[model samples]
Structures are given as C-alpha cells and as structure tokens.
Target chain A: MVRLITHNLLACHVKGCTTNNFPLVFQDVQVELQVAEFNPDFIRNMLSRLEWTALVNAAKQVGDTSLPPEQPDMMDDELLQKLHHVLMEIHVTDGAMVCQNCNHIYPISNGIPNMLLAEHEIG
Target chain B: MIPTPDLSHLTRHDLEQVYDPAEDTFLLLDALEQEAEALRKERPLICLEVGSGSGCVSAFLGKIFGQSSSLYLCTDINKHATRCTLATGKQNKILLDPITCSLAGPLSSRLCHAVDVLLFNPPYVPTDTDEASSAQSSADIAGSWAGGIDGMEITNRLLQDVECLLSPRGRFYLVALKQNDVPSIQSRMLEDFGLTSQVVIERRAGREFLLIIRFARTAHSGSGSTS
Candidate 1:
C-alpha cells in the first residue's frame, strides 16, 4: 500500500544504489480514493516529519497537485485538510515504484508493493 | 489507559480472512501500558510492528505516544490485514502507515538501526512446518496462527534481524508462548545480539501461557528492568 506518508520515507535500496535514490517515481499508478476523517491536529503534527519537497514532487507525479510547491510557514485549516486528503485519502492500489538512480522497478499488485530485491541486490 | 483502536469498520466477512484481536494482542497492550512511562521518556521517532494483523496494537501505541510524535509503520503478509489496519487507524484517529509485506521486507535495509520501538505478536502456535509454510504462502488468517516447528520458525527469522533494526536506545517487545522456549530465546539474544531482555508480563489464557518480553541493548536494558 503506497500512501504518500510511506512513500515520503522510502528510498531505493538496491545494494550500492545510493545517491539520488529517494522519492521512487510512481509509474502507471492506479489510485484508489478512500475518504478518511479529517483531523487538523494530526496533519499539523505530521508536517515536521515530512520532506516537503519530496512529498510535493511525489504528489505531482501521482497527479495530485493539491499541495503547493513550498510548505506553508503557517499551517491553516484549509491546507491541513488538503494535506490530509493527499496523505491519507489517496492510496496507490497498483503500479510500479521505479528508482530514479538505479532504475529498479518495485511492482505493486493488489495494493501491496513488492520491495524484495534479488539475492545479489541485498547488501 | 490507551484505548483499543475502533475495529467497528471491520465486518464479519473481513474478520474471516484477517486475525481479529485476541488474548495475545491484549497482552501486548498490557505490557505497553506497563512500560508507558519509559516509552514516553525514550521519545521514539519510529515504531514498527511486524504481523500487525488488526492494527489494534499499533493504534493503541499511537495513543500512548500521542498522534504526532512518531511514525507507526506496520507490516502484515495478509493484504486484508493491511487494509483493516489502515481502517482501524483511521477509525481511531491514528495515522498508521500500513504496508503489505512479509515482516519488514523492503524497509529493512533503509531502516537499519533506525527503529526506536519495535513490536511483534507473531504466529506462535506450534504447527507442522509444512502447514506453516503453506499458510505463510497463502497469506490469510491461517498465517496468523500457524507457527511452524515450536512456533519459532517465523520468530527466529525476525530475531536474527532485530539487532540491525533497533537503534542504540531502541526497545523491542515480543509476544511468545511458554511452549516457544522463552529462556533459550533470552539467552540467544544476549549472546548473539548483546540484547538483554526481561519478561514484562505473563498470563495464562486457555492452553496458552502468553508472555510479553522486552528486549533492548544491554546498556539500556535497565529501563525495562523491574529491579
């Protein structure tokens, strides 16, 4: 299940495939929209942990341009609601998360992404 | 006391394929409550739960740690478990990142030595090795309880990786049955990973003697020690 919250922290870990591995590109993504309860406090608290730029880029890649390019200095209710939808409501049901650096393709089937690498890919 | 996550969203049909909260889950919750003070003091940033069948444990943990302080990453081999977990988190107002993967899977390498608090209430029932393997391959409710060969087959694999997954001050809580040989497990962790452990809580439910064991780096083991 690729949520922006999980995707935000994920990077390509293919053996020595290190630098520029972050923000695995979402390709042929099949999005599932499920409405989650909106909680301003939860979204406010999550802001600090998120990589603003990476999340924004990933959101755009998945065709969700709701978030701004820059993280707002002051979080307002409206922005927090948008953040909630982007982070919690949207689920990537099926697709492949391709690494920009290593070009390793992690496929997602039935809402589960296969992050297992070949034996040689293990470091 | 932390409340159990609202599982009202899960229908009977959903529970048929997913493992519903059982005595083992409650035991883990009780152990967490016992260590609530220390856990808050540790101020963990990342918490990962393996085989998070119903997300009950992790959602309870979210309440103890508060909503915003840490990232709750939960994994279960069963796809339905992952979906149920997500819904449980939402119903409880806890944002959990539920990944459908087999016991840490792709996140292991990236999370090396980064997990602050880890939890696992694995399949600990003794069953035939072939049955366990098949259940695991099927990734259904059977995978939740069909522990192969003394119920250590799934647990042993995670034990080997615990040292690499835990941070210097990280703590791991595991639910085990008496039949699983708890003494040997504690000794092995001590010798191989230098992780000291103590039984946090124990209860006898039906035929199962449920035990919650807490493990941490030897130097920080004092935090969980009753003495």
Candidate 2:
C-alpha cells in the first residue's frame, strides 16, 4: 500500500535535484479507507516526528478533514480516532506524487509506488 | 539463614533468572510474544527490542523467524548489559544488532530505519520508600526497574520517541505489571496522543494484574473528534 509513512520518506529521484526534494506534492490521488487498530502510546510517541501541516493538507486533499489545525495537548479518544484514520487507513491506491522541487513525478499503481529512477536518472 | 541463590548462579545462562517470571518476565514476555505474532504476518521483518535484558527472548524470537530472514535489534541502557545480551543471542544463533544506550539517548538515523515491529519490556517496578532496600544501585539494575513511584517512569518517556522509528503498519507491544495504572496509561495514550489500543492479555490474581497492550499504526480514521 502507498502508506503515508512511505510517502514521508520519498523524494524526487530526478537528476540534479537535491534541495527540497521531499514532501512530495500529491496529485490526483485516489484514497482508500482500510480499518486498522490503534495504539495511543505509539501515536503519542510519533507526534514529534510528524509533519502536521503537510499531513493535514494531504488528508484534506483526499477529503479527510479530521485533524486539528494545531496538535492538542490532550490526546483524547476522539482526536486519536481521527488521527488513526488519517495516518493508517487512507491508502493512495492510485496516483502520482509530484516533487515540489524538481517537479519529478512518481507513479502509483495497484497501491505500489514506483520510486525507481529512469536509466539516465540513476547515479 | 538459607543463603539466597548466588547472583552468579541465578544469572547463569541469561538474565532470565534475575527476576521471578511470575513477578516480571512472564508478563513482559506475554506481551512481547502477542505482538510478535501479529508482526510476523509481514514476514522477513526487522524487529527492535527496547530494554532487552540478556537478549533471551529476542534470541527465541530470532530463532522462530530467522529461517525467513528476520533480524533482531536488542538494545539496553548500559554497555555491559548489551554485551551480555548480545553474547547470549549469538550463542543461541539469534541474529542481533546490539546497541548499548539509555532509553532517552539519540540513535543514528540509519539505526532508526522504519521498523516493522517494536517491543518493550521496560522497568515497570515502582521504587520503595526505603532507599536502602531499593534496587537503584547499578545503572543496569536501576534502568531495569524502578519506574519512578508508579512504574511508568522510563516507559512514559520511551513511548514518545517511538513514532520516528515506526514503519507504516508497524505494530507495538508493551508488557507492564497489573499495578502499573493501566487505565491511566490508556487514557493518556487515547487522550493525549492520537492512538488506539487493545488489551491482548490480562492475568488476574486478586489485586495483581498483567496487561498485554497492542497499538495500531499512527494513521487510521475514527479519532472520534468533536472538532
């Protein structure tokens, strides 16, 4: 599945494009909701590592407006459920991730993202 | 007076004998095993064991999943503990990358790669009022247990840093004593952090208890938010 975590680590592999290659801009995304369990402690621990603004924007693009504009001091079940959905269930089954920096595009098919570079792009 | 079993004899093969299973190890192992099985569904995985003592359990897990290309990272807060644990894992034919560091220590980004499974059998015993009788002498002994006054000391801090290392769909398991204020912990997780939880195991013996907890990946719907 094209998970947000995988999405977070990906960057444009295009040649001569180094700076700001990450936080790939999602375009024409197809979101799929799959049920998963929740672990609050894990999520609490993960808060420090998340890109809140980017995740919220991406989720909004996919019609999921569950996250708060700001992170809450208290992690209530209600907020957790929303965070849970945004982080785990929303799968990008089909779409293209366009790089904000180099404008390089990576395609997603059958839920698997193609992160491979073209023959000439390989270093 | 009958001489207490020699620490050397008790700790012979591994640290497994350091604590009575009924009191500590069994509860933690129960929780670790429960989550380990679920994580195994994604075969050929890499598991991280935080606060791994003597590396016995990780070794056992490595053996079970080693045939399928799984590797275990057994870590501890002290260097000597890591050495001992690594030696045991190696002797038992378990693939392990042993790291010696504190729970709050920094890890290299390479070592912090997205992990499929995270297990913790942290020190969950509260300190006694009598400092003389407390097990807070050695760093290993102190790090091994002494969870503040309530037994959530190290564990509480450890949970906050796990997100950076967790892979998508990664599973987490924590084994804590029945007296460790589970409801408060759950509430803290559900309320303060955005995560869901399930009680996988609970052993009831009058006032005492042991809980096996499992958490979902960070992203998933049903935050039940009012906003």
Candidate 3:
C-alpha cells in the first residue's frame, strides 16, 4: 500500500521523466486508518530522511492536515505523534499515483501500487 | 555481523497472521552475513526484498549495509506481513519501505537493472496448485509456505524477473528446500539468464533440508564464491 513513508522516497520513474516527479499526486484514494504503537525515537530518526515539504503536501492531499507546513526544530511529542499517524496509520487502498511531470498514472489496486511502465516508457 | 533486527515488538497475535522468522529466515540471514564484506564493497544503492515476511531479513540487511546509503524496499502480498515488516523496521531503527504487493508487482519495471541486492525466502512447501493459488490470493499466513507442485510455482514466476532486476554487480539470495530441486534452479538461471549461482549454506532441519543459494552475473563471479 502507499504509505506516506514509502511515498516519500518514490518519484516518477518514467523514461526522461525526472524533474518535479516527486510526491506523486494521490487521486480517488481509499484511506484506511491503522493505529501503530507510537515510538517518538523512530519518528525523530526519520525526520532527516523525509522530504518535509513533500510529506506535508501529501498529507494535505490525503485530507490529513495534522502536520505543520514546515518541520519544527523542536522534537515535540505532538508533532511526533502526528508524523507517526501520517506515515504509519494512513493506507491508500485504492487510487492512482499521478506523476506531476510525465502525467503517468500508477494505479493502486488491492492496496498495491503498480509502478510498472510501458515498454516504451522504459529508461 | 550486524545483529538481527529486534522483533520483540511483534506480539504473538501479530505472529499468528504473519510469517515469523524461522529456519528459512535464519538461513537467509546467514547467507547475507557470509556476503557482508562483498556487499559492502559493491556499495549497493538499492536493495529489494520480495516477500519480506516479518521484515527480519531486510532489517538485518539494512543494519549490515547501513541505512543511509541504500533504499530498502520490500514487497509482500500479505497486508499483515507488510505491517509487521514496518513495525520491525521501526523497532530496529531501519527505514524499511514495505509495499503490500505480490512479488514486486509494481516495482519490477522501474527497478529494472537497478536493484543491487535482491532477497527472497518464498513459500517453498509442496502442496496442490489450488492450495497455493488460494493462499497467494488470500494474502494470509498460508501464503508464506504453500508453494505448489514441487514448490516452484511461485519461485518460478520470480526467477523470470531476476535477470531484469539485478544490477551488474547485484546479488540475489534465495531460500529453498531439497525438494525444490536446487540444481535445476541454478542451471535454469545460468542457461536462461546467464546468472551463475552456488549454494552458500545448507542445513537439515527435521525432515526438510534447507539451502541458501546465491546467484550473480557471470562477470562478477570471483569476488564472493562459497560453494
């Protein structure tokens, strides 16, 4: 499934589709909320790896506006909990991840994102 | 060797649904341990684990390779396995990206020739074709050990993609049973994909003889051969 953590690292892999490929736009998504055990340290460690702006934007797109627009310097419990929920709880069951640059749509069915491209789209 | 990922967070309830680390899992870990030096030397950028049940193997890999350098991507058809994998990674301080899909379903095309380390400990138990298909479609714990018809049904499908997935210096590790016909698998990969392989480790656990086989492209051969 497309979780924010996984989505954070994904970019449009279409041939010659490089710039502005990140943060694939989620459309018609079916979100399932699962509660994972909260671990502040884990979230704190993940902060450096995350694309903060992209995560907040993606969260907003998925109707989760809990995260602040910018990543706060202080590692507060409130922010960590929000990050945990955004990254771990939310699951995109059904949708298409549309690439911003290529307009290539990678569909998610049965909670699996089909990242495969056409033979011609192979880089 | 890097310590195995801490799975204390996973409860018995969770283990009931997901495939817990067992003999097969440990064999894969040992195989990875055997190749630790070579893997570090190659400096893999991307590591993909197909059917990452319980996430132990991948987490161990992340620990060995260092989390910052490579992207640790994992796939499993079972949703519970994916969740367990995520939790395991978190507990171990490894950033594992677990995707709930069947055998690199969506990742194959994009990851073409980009995966530097590929790992799979598939369902190698012999069973009827229907049972295996049902288990796979159900995406449950049964899918963890219900290989059909000589236990190659699922492995066969993945073997077709190995050549496409591996980078030039890539390494693939597979866990199999004696009944799975290890020799044929190695020969087939060599003939069809030009991939050479050797048995890295083997142990008899009860009636099942488990083997960990390592496969790599012919050009990258002399560095890590453990027959």
Candidate achieving higher lDDT, 1 or 3: 1
The numbered model that scores best in TM-score is 1
lDDT of 2 at B198: 78
Error of 2 at B190 (Å): 2.7
True lDDT of residue B87, candidate 3? 80
Cα lDDT of model 3 by residue, B1-227, tens digit? 56878999999999999998988898889888988998998867678999998999999998997765566899888878888887888799876777766786656655666678999999999999999988987789999999999999999999999999887778899999999999999999999999999999999988889999999999754346321
Q: What are the runs in model 1 whose C-alpha is more than 4 Å off?
A: A11-23, A30-94, A99-123, B220-227
Error at B138, model 3, angstroms: 0.7
> Which fraction of the native contacts appears in each prediction?
0.27, 0.00, 0.11
If ranked by lDDT, best first, what sequence of candidates would result?
Answer: 1, 3, 2
Clashing pairs in 1: none
Cα RMSD (angstroms) for every candidate in the order listed:
5.1, 16.9, 8.3
Q: Score the docking of each candidate (DockQ).
A: 0.27, 0.02, 0.11
Predicted chain B of candidate 3, TM-score versus the true chain B: 0.96
List TM-score per model, in order. 0.79, 0.53, 0.71
Candidate 1 residue A102 Cα shift, in angstroms, is 7.2
Local accuracy of candidate 3 as per-residue lDDT tens digits, A1-123: 577877876777777887887778988898988666566665675566568999999998889988888778897888888888998778787888898887889888655576645556756
TM-score of chain A of 3: 0.96
Candidate 3 to truth, TM: 0.71
Stretches of candidate 2 off by over 4 Å are A1-123, B1-23, B31-37, B108-113, B128-138, B204-208, B218-227
Q: Tens-digit lDDT track for model 1 on B1-227?
A: 66777888899999999998989999999999999999998777789999998889999999998766677899898888988887888789887887766787767766777788999998999999999988887789999999999999999989999999987788999999999999999999999989999999999999889999999997754355321
